[model samples]
Target: MSLDYDLVIIGNSLEASYAAVKAAKLRARVALVLGETETNTYTEIDRSTFNCLTYLDKKGQNLTQWELNYDFVTHLNSSQIQTWITQVKQDIKEYYSPAILADLGIDIIGESGEFCRLPALGFVIKNRTLRSRNYLLAMGSISSIPKIEGLSELGYLTLETLDLENLPYDLIILSQTPIGIELAQSLNHLGKKVTLVVEDSNILPQEDAEAVQLIQAQLEAEGIKLLVNCPITQVRKIEDKKWIQAGNEALETDEIILITKPTPNIKGLNLEGVKVEVQPQQIIVNDKLQTTNPKIYACGSIIGGYSLSNLAKYEANIVIKNAIFYSIFQVNYHPLPFHIFTHPILSRVGLTETQARQSYGDDIIIIKQNYKTLAKAQILDETTGFCKIITRRNGIILGGHIIGNNSDELINFIALSIKNNIKIQQFSQLFPSYYTISEILFQISENWQYQKLQENKFLNNWLETLLFWRRRWKL
Candidate 1:
């Protein structure tokens, strides 16, 4: 069987679905071949695990209702989030309507798509026979498995299957990530022995260090054994006893969980015939999300870019504008905000101190403020993290990183600041009052710019003299 359309989206994700919907709206005939049942499969997982009711903090104090509510409420008020919610809703209403998609000649082939070959033109997707087209591969990714001996025989769960219900087990060994950490914490709170092994220096390595530390402390307080810098080498189950080997040591556990990396789900699609290149584990795509062949494009996790759902959606928008409308839209990932859904949540945008230092130099200034100093954080009893801002010599906001309650929501303001190249003084002037964690940026700006100048003796002396003269003149 053969069908023709202006565009054929090869995955049913937030990215692919939105792209299909937008293209159809632009009066282009589109089709979507989906491997999954729905657009937001990961979102259907039990997010209640991240709720404060699941675990306790370092002080052995249970998370208050206010703290959870505050985080939830603040997330609703985020500027970046409002846009996402609106876009997603619009896309769903348009594409999900059978009449609209049918009217636009948009066909959704709900099947587990397989790649047949990589030809000189594009990949051939085979359900049974060879299906070729000007394809947009958005097949997404799967969790990476560690090369551990006997792991296959012992049985393990990836992030995709970790939330299976009513599975009784005495102990669970988790490789740390957002999903792994939340699972470990939730299981531990539910009265299970959970050991979390992190290959990185911290649990959420992508998050702010202070935030990682706070989350680590909280997990440890809840009796979650956190092993850092240790790579699991082997897993074997002998006579119902599971032995996990990690760095010259063996720990016995009932279950093992992998959260290391996510492999792109593009193996079955036979790409060799189409000659579309697949390097290592990712598909090559240009700024416009086009593959080597101009007619073919790719997006989402398959492109090996930022794996956040929101980022994928953003890329989808760009693809629709460029591919269908022929608009001069290019993908710009700068100031891309990310959030780690831990208890207090860790969020960041633009650059980190390490990244900024690499781009700039030692002359860069870092301003750090603790969440304890924030009135709302203290009142909510979740003041365990801090916010750090990286700026240049001229007080240009280089990046913003926050590890505290509502950090995910708070990072949006910083994302906007970095996007607009808003200066430190401008940020301070706009947000002068301390109403919430969002105002913490302004508070940091007030001290950060002047402190750098004060550290320079010559500049400090000149400023002091100028201040004295102004006082004498009463100006």
Candidate 2:
């Protein structure tokens, strides 16, 4: 059967546009179907607001705690940010102009898309019907609004549709992700009474116990009320405020914000018409980013497992190889570090301790080192969390978890170590520069050896074996 385009991407997600570029680069006839009707909300924030600028005091280490009057929020102009986002969106569209893409043997579709099978396996977007050999579904996801009894009827705040100018006196944040927790604390620091509600037993359901415990402590210390393992039974308006019935407790709040997991955006695509298998929450995709149907491929929110834009782009490349080139490129989800951008960030690489125990049994070695022990942390007065590294009984590193000032960046080294099959004993030699957050990695690695020496001769035995082999590398 003849096809209109070689590759067709549906949806306006950044990943969708990026996949179009990748496909065009690979010398394929690409067509992107997107709705330019609505403003792109994801990139609405100014780039400068994201760049971290730290204020240093005497001796050049102590962080200056500045908010309202001196923080980045003080400089945020809603109108300017919106303008920038609009400009960026236009830039993306123009950069991949039809004329430019035509030179690369690609086409374009600017409308809503749906799959049809009657005439042929194709996408019908408004007036134009496009037939493609393969389809890359980079359609992003929507906010997972839980099935609260009266939530739909009585309106609530979502991260996407939040109004910053209209501040509520007391806010109830129903959340399940780290972004929710970060917002809770951040809004609290902004002088709002905030209560965070988590359906799970603890904050960060997927994080290590130690990281969770530390973050939970810090959240409480920051005066953010946590209602853990508690979900709303009913929501209704009580004159000026909103009343919530949550697990035998009644609470009243000025407004409610939902920060839940992202539900896949596969609606109206008529996926069932094409025999594509989709879960209630997400579309089922294999490691290679291929859907249940060989001709259909997916990434981004539809595939689930990730919420970050970068992860979606990574998945998009995998789909390009598997769907376009007929090559196998799998995602190593584990050893993929994640960070919650809270004041004291929470980050983890590889498996959680619970996950490690489940996979390797109870024989896995565990070592924990606190940022409080580091002079750099003391100098900065940012000693609120610790780093925990897990390894095998024979000295192979398994996983790492960090919750501290620089936990976000610190987790990367641990992730690389796990990815490269580097062991804990070898980490001590991987020293970072003096008086830095990275030194914690080297200290923890040295501590791992000490712990092993006290508990077992695991480190010594590995060293003896290395000496016996006399294996030396010329680096």
Most lDDT-accurate candidate:
2
**How high is the CA lDDT of each candidate model?**
0.68, 0.74
- Per residue, candidate 1 scores C-alpha lDDT tens digits across 271-315 of 554566777557888888887766678887777744677788788
Give the C-alpha lDDT of model 2. 0.74
Q: Compute the lDDT of residue 190 as modeled in candidate 1.
A: 57
Question: Which ten-residue region of model 1 has the weakest summed lDDT?
Answer: 72-81
Q: After superposition, how far is residue 280 of candidate 2 from its true place, in Å?
A: 2.5
Stretches off by above 4 angstroms in model 2 are 39-106, 455-475
Model 1: lDDT equals: 0.68
lDDT score of residue 466 within candidate 1: 99
